[model samples]
Target: MLSNFDIPLLLGLAVLATLGMVTMYSAGFDHGSRFVDHGRNMLLAALILFTVAQLPPQRLVQLAVPLYTVGVVLLVATALFGITKKGSTRWLNVGIVIQPSEILKIAMPLMLAWWFQKREGQLRPLDFGVAGALLLIPVGLVMKQPDLGTSLLILSGGLYVIFFAGLSWRIILPVVTLGAAGIGLIVIMGDRLCEPDVDWRVLHDYQKHRVCTLLDPTKDPLGKGFHIIQGMIAIGSGGLSGKGFMQGTQTHLEFIPERTTDFIFAAYSEEFGLAGVLTLIATFTFVLMRGLMIAAEAPSVFSRLLAGSLTLSFFTYAMVNMGMVSGILPVVGIPLPFISYGGTAMVTLGLALGMLMSIARSRRIMQT
Candidate 1:
C-alpha cells in the first residue's frame, strides 16, 4: 500500500529540500555548522514525512481531536510559564524549547478537516460558525502571546479548510469587505489609534509599530524603519540579473540583519537578482498547484480539506515573507518555506507535503 505513494509529490519535496540545503549553505557563509544543522533537520523532516505518509487518511482523522486537545493544553502551559524571548512568551520547555503555536499550525487544520469530514454533505452556516470558533480560539491565544505572524498563518490555514469545505463566496465576500473597511478605518485613525494612552487595546506596541512603519517608513527612517529600508535597498540593488552568487555586498557586508532568517529573501535577491527571485517564486507556485491538484483528487473530504489548507498555508508563508521584506506589509517573522533557515518550519512543511502525497496516492489506489 505504501509503495503506491505519489512519486511526483515526493520528487517535489526532494527538489525543495535540495534547494533549501543549497540556499542555507549560501546564507550561512562562514558558519558551516548552520548548514550541517539544516541538513540534520531536513533528514529528520524526511523521516517524519515518510512515516506519516504511510498512515491511511482515516487514521489521520482519528488523531485530530487528540492532537488538537494536546496542542491547546500546551498553548495554555506556554501562557503560564513559557520562556520569554524578545518580549514574547510563546515557547514551552518540554525537554526541548518548542513553540506551542507551531503545533496548532498543523493541528488546527487537522481538527477542522475532521469536523468537516464528520458533517460531510451536510455543512451549513452554523457549521461554518463552529469552524470559525475553532479557528479563532487558537488565533486569539497566539495573538495575545504576541505572535502575530504565526497566529495569522494558523488562521489562514484553518480558513482554507473552511473554504474548501464548500463555503459560499456569498458569505465570504461580506466578511472580506468588512475586514477591508476595518483596516481602512484603522489607517484613517492611525495617529490616535496608536497614541500612548488610549482605550484601543487591539494591538501590541511592536505590532502597532510595524503597521505604522508600513504606512510611512520614512517617519522613523533610521530607527524602526531600518529593516524595511535596508531590505528595499538590497532588492532594488539586485537589478535584472543580480550582482552574482556570493558577491552580494549587502549580504556579505552584513548590512542586512536576519539575512539567514526572516529577511533572507532580500539577501537572496541582492545576490541572485530578479531572475533568481522569479525562479524561487515559480518553484513555490509549482508546489502549491501540485498540492491543490492532489486535494482535488483526494478520496475523502478529510484528505481534501487537509491537503488544500496545507497548500494555501504554504502560499501564505511565502507571500507574508516577501511582502514584509518588500516593505508593503508589516514585518511579520514568517520564514520563506523551504528556503529560510529553521528546523521546525521545515518539518511542518514536510508534514504538509507528505499529507498531499498521501492524498494523491490514495486517489490513485481508489481509481485502480
Candidate 2:
C-alpha cells in the first residue's frame, strides 16, 4: 500500500491541503470552529484516499455498475422525497442527509469507463448515444432540482469519459460552435433580453439572471452583482504581491461573501495576489499532469478512461471556481477544490485522486 503511492501527486495534494488550511485559518477564524473543521475534513479525505488506493483497477471496474445504479436511484429518490434548502431539493434523507448529485460526480465517469471497456472493439455511434443517455439521466434530475453547478460537474465528468473513449471531434465541434454563437447573440442582445418582463423560456428566472448579471454586473451592482463585484475588488486590491496572509481587508471586513466556501478564491487572492494564485495554479497543474500521466500509462482501457475523466474533473472544478471568482464567468456555486471548505466536495476529490493512484499502482506492477 505504501509503495502504491504516486509521490508527485501526493506532494501536490499535500501542498494544496496545507494552503487550504492556512487560508481557512485566516478566512474562517471568526466563524466558530470552521478552521478546525476544515482540518478535520482534510484528514477524513486523506483517510478515504488511503483506503481507496488499496483497491485495484479491476475492483473499481467491478464496482462501477453497482455504484452508478445506486447513485441514479438515490437521485430519483431525492427528486421524490428530499430536503429543500435555499429553494433547491438536492439532498436525500437516508440515514443522514446526503446530496445525491454529488454521487454522480464519480459514478458517472466510472460507469461510462466501464461501458466503453466492455464495448472495446465493437464501437458504434449507438454506443456513444447510449453513453450520452446514461450521462443525461442524472444530469437532468439534478437540473430539475435547480442545482446547475453539480449537474455541470457531473456532465463534464461523463463527457470526458465519452471523449476519451473514441468520441470524434466531428460530433463535438458543431455543438461548440453553436454554443459560441449563442453566447455572441446574448452579448449583442443583452439589454433587451435582460429586461424584467422578457422571458427566456429555456432557463429559470434565477438562471437567466445569473447570465444577464455576468454580462453587465452594474445592472444591479448591489444585488445580483454583489458577489462578482466584491470578488473582483478583492482580486484587484491584492495587486502583484498581495497584502500578505491574514491581512485581506475585504475578507476580514466581511465584504467578500462566502469567504469560507464558494467565494474563498476571492479571499485567497486578496491576501496572496497574482503570485500566490500562480503558485496555486502551478500546484494544481502538477497534480493534473500527474493524473494524465497515470492515465496514459494505465494497464487497461477502463483504467485509462476512468483516470483521464477523473483528472479532467479536477480541471473543471478549478477552472469554474476560479473563473466565477474572477468575474469572467457566471457566479456558479462551485468550490475551489482543496481550497474550499466543503466536506462532501473534499471527500469526493479524495475518492477521485485515489482512483488515479490505483491506476498508477497497477501500471507500476505491470512494469515490474
Candidate 3:
C-alpha cells in the first residue's frame, strides 16, 4: 500500500495542505473552533484520498455509469424537492442534507472517459454528441439549482475529457472565438447592459448583479459589490512580502468577508503578500504538472482521460477562486482547493486526487 503511493504528488499535496492549515489558523482563529474543524476536514480528505488510491482504474470505470446515473437522479430530486437557502435550492435531504452537484465534479469526467473508451476504435461525431448530451443533462439540472460555481466545475471537467478524447481544434476554435467576442461586447456595453430595467433573461437577477459588480465594484461599494471590493483590497494590501502572519489588518479587522471559505484567497493574500501567493501558485502548478505527467503515462484510455480531466479541474478551481478574489471574474463561490475551508469541497477534491493517484499506481504496477 505504501509503495502504491506516488511520492512527488503526495509531497505537493502535503505542502498545500500544510499551508491551508496555517492560513486557516490565522483566518479563523476568532471564529470558535473553525481552525480545529478545518484540520478535521483535512484529515477526512486524507482518509478519502488513501482509500480511493487503492482502487484500480478498471474498478473505477465500473463505477462510472452507476455514479453518473445516481448523480443525475439526485440533481433531479434536488430540483424537485431540495432545501432552499438564500434563494437557491441546491441541497437535498437524503438521510442527511447533501449537495448532489458535488458528485458531478468527479462523476462527469468518469462517465465521459468511460463513454469514449467504449467507442475507442470506431469513433464518430455521433459519439461526441451523445457524450455532450450526457454532460449537459446534469449541467442543466445544476444550473437550474442556480449553483453556478459547481455547475461550472462539472461542465469544465466533462469538457476536458471530451477535449482529450480527440475533440478537433476545428470545433473548439470557433466556440472560443465566440466566447471571446461576447466578453468584449459585454465590456463595451457594460453601463447599458447593467441597467436595472434591462432583463438578462438567461441569468437570475442576483447573478446579473454579480456580473455588473465585477465590471465596476465601486458602483455599489457597500452592497452587492462588497465582496469583490473587499477581496481586491486585501489582495492589494498584501504587498511584496506581506503584513506578516496573523497580522492581516484587512482579514482581522473584518474587511475581507468569508475569510475561511469562499473568500479565503483574499485573506491569504493579505497575510502572505505577493511572494506567498506566488509560492502557492507554484505548488499548485507542480501538482498540476505531476498529474498531467501521470495522465500522459496512463496505460489505458479510460485512465488517461480521467486523469487529465481531473487534473485540469484543479486548475479550474484555483484559477476561478483566485480570479474572483482578485476582481478579474465574477464571484461564483468556488473554494481554493485545499486552502479554502469547506468539508464538501475538500472531500470532492480528495476524490479527484485519489483517482489520479489510482491511475498513477496502475502504470507503475504494469511497469513492474
Candidate 4:
C-alpha cells in the first residue's frame, strides 16, 4: 500500500513532520520534560498518519457518521463534566484529559461530506440549512465552553465542507453581506457591545475581553492586552534577519506567554527572522495546494469534501496563529500548525494529512 501511494504528497508530509519535531524540540527545551513529551507525540502522530494513509478513502467515508456521532457525544460530555482550566471548560477526562472539540474539527467535515454525497446532484437551500444546523450544534457547544479559538476553527472546517459541496453563491452572498454588516456594527458600537450594565447576555466576559483587546490593545496594556503587545514586539523586533536561533531575548527571558504553544510563532519569528517565516509559509502553501488538488481528483464527494475542509482548516490554523502573534487579530489560543508544541494538536494535524493522502491515493487508483 505504501508503495502505491502518491510519493510526492507522502514525502511532503514527512518533511513537515520532521520540521514539527525540530521546532517542538527548540520550543520545549527549557521547560524540562516537555521536549521528551513532544518527541513522543511526534512519533505517535507519524504512526497515525501512516496508518490512516494506508486505509481506502471509501472505508473512511463509511466510518464518517459513526465517528461524528461519537465525537459529538464526547463534546456534550465535556460540557457537563469537563476539567476547567483558565476559565474554560474545554477538556474532558476519560483517564486522560482530552479536548473533544478537536475531534469535531475533523469529524464535522467528514459527516457533512457524507451527507452531501447522499444528496449529490440534488442539493437544495433547505439541505444547506440542515448542514448549517449540523455545524452549529458542535460550534455552539464549544463556544459555550468558551473555547473561542477552537470553536472558530471547527466552524471554519464545517464551512469548507459547505463550500466544496457546490453550495450556491446565491445563498453564500447574502450570508457574507450580513457578516460584513455585523462586523461593521460591532466596530461602530465598540465597548458598548458588551456593557456590564447592559443585557450582558450575548458573549462570555472573556470572549468580550478578547474582542475589546483586538480593538485597542493599549486600552488594557498591562492586563489582557499584554499578550498581543508582547507578541507584536517579538515579531517586529526580528526585523529582516532574526536575532539568531535560541537567542530570542523575549522568549528566553520569558516575556512571551505560551512560548511553546499559541504564541510560538512570535518566538520563531524572533529567532529565525523574515526569511525563515517565508520558508514556513511557503511550505504551508504547498501542502494546502497539494491537498486541494487531491480533493479535486477524489473518487467520491465525501473524500473531496473531507480533503478540502482539512486543507482549509490547516490554512486557518496557520493564518489565525500568525495573525494573533502579529497583533492584527485577537489573542486566541490557537497553535501554529506543526510548529507549535502540543501532542493532541500534532496528532489531529497528522490525521488530517493522512486523510488527504488517502484521498490522493484513492484517486490514483481510480485513474488506473
RMSD of each: 1.9, 0.9, 0.7, 1.9
Residue 75 accuracy (lDDT) in model 2: 90
Best by lDDT: 3
Minimum summed lDDT over a 10-residue window in model 1 is located at 192-201
TM-score attained by model 4: 0.94
Q: Candidate 2 on 61-123: residue-level lDDT in tens?
A: 999999999999999999899999989898888898899888899999999999999999999
Off by over 4 Å in 1: 1-3, 186-200
- lDDT per model, in order? 0.86, 0.93, 0.94, 0.84
Say which prediction, candidate 1 or candidate 3, comes out ahead on lDDT.
3
Report the lDDT of model 2 for residue 329. Answer: 88
- For 1-368, candidate 4 gives per-residue lDDT tens digits of 57667787766666666666666566677878876787787788778888898899888888888988999899899989999998889889999888899999889988899999989989988999999999999999999998888889989999999998888898899999999998888789877864566554677777778887888889888998999999989888887888887788988898888988899888888887888788788888888888888888877778888889998899999999999888877888788876788888989988988888878877877788
lDDT tens digits by residue: candidate 1, 1-368: 45688776666667767767776777788655888888888888888878788777878888899999999888888999899988999999999989989889899999999999999878779999999999898898899898999999999999999988888999899999999999899789888776667555688878888888887788888898989999999999999998887788888887888888898899888878899888888788887888888888888889989999988998899989999999988999899887788888988877877776767777887888
lDDT of 3 by residue, 91-118 (tens): 9999999999999999999999999999
The parts of candidate 3 lying over 4 Å away from their true place are: none
